[model samples]
Target: MSRIEARIEDLGLALPAPMLPPGNFKLVNVYGGLAYISGHPAIDGSTVLVQGVVGRDLTVEEGYEAARLAALSIIASLKHELGDLDRVTSWLRAVGYVQSAPEFHDNAKVVNGFSDLIIEIWGEAGRHARSAPGQGPSPLDVPVIIDAIVAISE
Candidate 1:
């Protein structure tokens, strides 16, 4: 196995089967030595793992898990595009959008789910600039959606 996939196995994690982009947009675009991943919702096939706004139908913790699931899908997308996760040299940036209730304010904490898994698998290489912003709703009404950019071997 490639180093990253082996690390994922060591972490007791598995990448979900990759889902195609719902629209015409490309799932990832590699250019200038960076791979741009599109936003991914917390989905396994057609099933939405968790939906509804945080602080309403879901707790902060649930939102975190949702973000983590979405991150798995993001990793799947990376694998689909790059063929080998080891090609990823560094995580450059990420924007995690949390579907949240009006009173919710822990967007960053929720987004930590996505970052946590990345760091777990890639160690310091996964560290990156991030934005965890609150949103009223997200595509497919998922509790969280995350998009990323990573430096990769060409």
Candidate 2:
């Protein structure tokens, strides 16, 4: 197994199957050693494991886990395209959208779930510039959505 995969195993993280795009867009596209992943819902394909607005029905911790799940979905998409996690050179950036109430502004703390998981698996290389925002809703009203960019070595 790749080092990242091994680390994921150690950390009790398993890559979920990449979600098929609900529309015409592709899940991921790679060119020039960069992979751009589409926004991933926090669903596990069966259903959304978490739902509702942050600070209303869900706590920040709950939102964090949801974001982590979204990140895992992106990782699954990456593995689908690249065949091996070890080929990843670095996490370039991430965009996180949170379905949240207007009063809640802790989107960054929620997105840290994904960042922390990446750091656990990729060490320093996984740290990246990130944008997290409170949004009105997502495809399924899921608590979180995430998209990522990763650089890979050929």
Candidate that would win on TM-score: 1
Cα distance off (Å), candidate 2, residue 62: 0.3
Question: Model 1 off-target regions past 4 Å?
Answer: none
Top-lDDT candidate index: 1
TM-score of every prediction relative to native: 0.97, 0.95
lDDT of 1 by residue, 1-154 (tens): 8999999999898888886778899889999999999888887756677878888999989988988899889898889888999999999999998889999999999999999989988999999999998987677888888999999996
Question: After superposition, which runs of candidate 2 have C-alpha atoms over 4 Å from their true positions?
Answer: none
Instruction: Return the TM-score for candidate 2, rounded to 2 decimals.
Output: 0.95
lDDT of 1: 0.89
Task: Give the lDDT of residue 48 in candidate 1.
Answer: 73
Task: Count clashing residue pairs per candidate.
Answer: 0, 0
